[model samples]
Target: MFDGIKILNADADIQKLMYSSVLDWNSVVNDGTGEVVGRTAEYNNLTLTIKEETSLVKVTGSLHKYANAGIHNADDFTPERLAGVLDSIQKLGIGINSALNNLEFGVNIETPFPPAKLLERLICHQRREFTRHVSKGFEYYQCEHERQFVVKIYDKGRQFGLRSNLLRFEIKVLTMQVLHKKGIGIYTLSDLLNQKLYPKIGNLLIQCFNEILFDEPTIDTTNLSKKDSDLLINGRNHKFWRPFSESNFETKQKYDTARKMRYRQEKRFRQMIDSSPTAERLHKLAAELIATKWEILSNPIVPLLHYTLNVEMGQSIIPTAKECPITGIDISDQKGSSRYLSERTLKSDPELLKSLPVTIGQQRRRKHHHPEEYYVAHNIRNAASNPRNSIKRRIERAVKNTPLFQADEVIRLTDEQKKILQSVPSNVPRNKKPR
Candidate 1:
């Protein structure tokens, strides 16, 4: 459910605990200056880096790997397991309330088709083109990096060398403002312990994928009428349905007719895709992903024994209860936690293991055409006369200076304000300017 995370500006005491007998920290020196500027340490699959100048400690690693013996995150990371991992971190003196600088949530699922083929067909996301990237053996398609978030659809099976056709769809939240906009008020690690919020998070992930525009190869034009063929062909090129305007066209009637034609075409095209066989299968996978997420997130989380996933057998293996090295207490005797998944249930119902999937839909329209000769002048004109309204202007302002966990403080007021404020009278000779 959750993967890579970064904790920034850890407390002094927590920094000491990270460098104590628990893990050894080695000094990092500047090659040119020969001066120690920081210290770093690797604990399991997690890494902690400390800067000498600011005395700030940053921790970066996969929460899934940390919970699963510092190994691959190819299995379902249940909410119950997440709670146990959070408990262990709290015991280690790393405050669970620590603010997260970066957070990623995704699911690994066995796709109906090859992930590579799917990536090839995935052309655009909200009008922004996808940039292909390969890290390790995993291949992924990602949209242009935005300040709020980055969406990734990658081959998880290839990354881990699994024999299954596993695809991972993830959203990397670069800022918490994105979460705030989605009504997810998570600010720190402690907020993640709320099992009730799992459905909201799952829905958010689904929504991100839903906004993607797919160029489905399954669309066949052979049996289609002229009208259907026009929509199918025009919709695929994203630019054929351009916005109509007085400057673009000579007459108002002409632009109006063009706008109406494209509008009708777009509506019909959406309906066509909604009823198509390929679309149905894609939506079905999305439905399954959300259902599984809801089931796991709603489960009671507890400090249960650590478990590992057996990919071959598709089972989660939990060994016999033993004392934890950090806390010096029996794992079964932990207090103040909910008993969500017991040892008996896990062994008997390994079939409960599953993952998530999603679909996409969104479009972008260009406002004007540029003169090829005047590149510099065209860029200046575009920047000054861009089609940004009040809401977009506010968002741009917020993105410039907002903190990761503080964007909530600077949003617009709700609609339930005073009626006077909602409908202010225009200034006149008799109307005095209000201070």
Candidate 2:
């Protein structure tokens, strides 16, 4: 019975009238027509149709039942109620606009599209056709993935609540899927909200969509090499490609031989020091020889000349007053003692003293002490000479140097103080001089 109902392209005036009206099922139905049939409203697609009735207004075809209901409802419907309902819808539109303004992907139009308008028109047309349609409720439609999804509002009381929840859910799910496919992980509903509101994220989303979906194909990774792969891995142990060359082999062989020689020399030195009875003495002598050699190589001329000059000058070369004076026993004895230093005789000699060069540490310590003492004494002398009295001296010098009286200074004084200063007698009274 609900077939061949052709919905014509409604005129602007009719469309406006339908949206402005607030007709419902119970309000449109007339009980006098031998068991009135209740009209069902599809909430999802927002479509409504009424059953044909044999009455004063006969509706035989698809348009018959709707026409009958519309006539009946319009006869009793008040203009004030219709206006109030229209106002409510207008307010809802305003709210939706405000909400879209804050969205990352803002609404494309100032008003709802043709599809939305079609649904709205059908809703109002059904309401006017059936008496209890508004009281019974309506449906909303969602077209997703090439499939139709319906949301039925059976009870009028839940119309607003259900519609709001479904709308919010639909928006969230759509945005999540879109963002997720673009490599964005929507961990929570809050993430979607943030992306929708945050300006940076919103701009990034637009940029990503423009580049990946609309821009030219530019990324080419087909020709990537092994070196590129190693770089991408960012690993220290990664094997890098080395060019095949004769020089490479020669360089590797040289490095290996030098390393092997260094290892053998170190091992021999370690074994020698570990086995010898005078190992400590030999090691010390080696170290001293190396250090002396390094010094000689660094300044060969200066050190050699200095030593030669010392020998020529006979400094510390003559024998001490206690030793044989004529033979200069100190020099001859030192040479003889150096040869027998490993034996016990030289060690037991009461007159002979070991001669050793001062170490770097000892020289530094000797040089640092006098300079450190001098700095400490200098600071102490400065503190004693000035003391805290320097502050007083500075203040006294400033006071003496500055002009005691000035026009600006007089201006700064209080009126009473200034008057008192001006009234002070310049000369003492004659009577006061007698005292």
Task: Specify the highest-TM-score model's number.
Answer: 1
* Candidate 1 global CA lDDT score: 0.59
Encode model 2's per-residue lDDT on 267-352: one tens digit a residue.
44334333444322222222222222222122112211111111212432111222211111233344331311222322445333
State the TM-score for model 1: 0.61
Number of clashing residue pairs, candidate 1: 2
Model 1 C-alpha lDDT per residue in residues 1-435, reported as the tens digit of each score: 878888887533555465477678888999999999998887657787889898787878888898887888888787667767766665555666678888898877665556676666564565566778877765678875557789888878888888876778888988887888866777877666543456567767776777565655677677778988877776777465444557888888988888777667666876776666544345334434433433333332343445442222254434334332111223344332312222332233334211111111011126644332233223322322222223245456776767664655665432211221333222222365433
In angstroms, give how far residue 182 of model 1 lies from its true place: 2.2
Runs with alpha carbons beyond 4 Å of true place in candidate 1: 12-15, 237-266, 277-280, 297-435
Best by lDDT: 1
Full-model lDDT for every candidate:
0.59, 0.26
In TM-score terms, candidate 2 sits at: 0.14
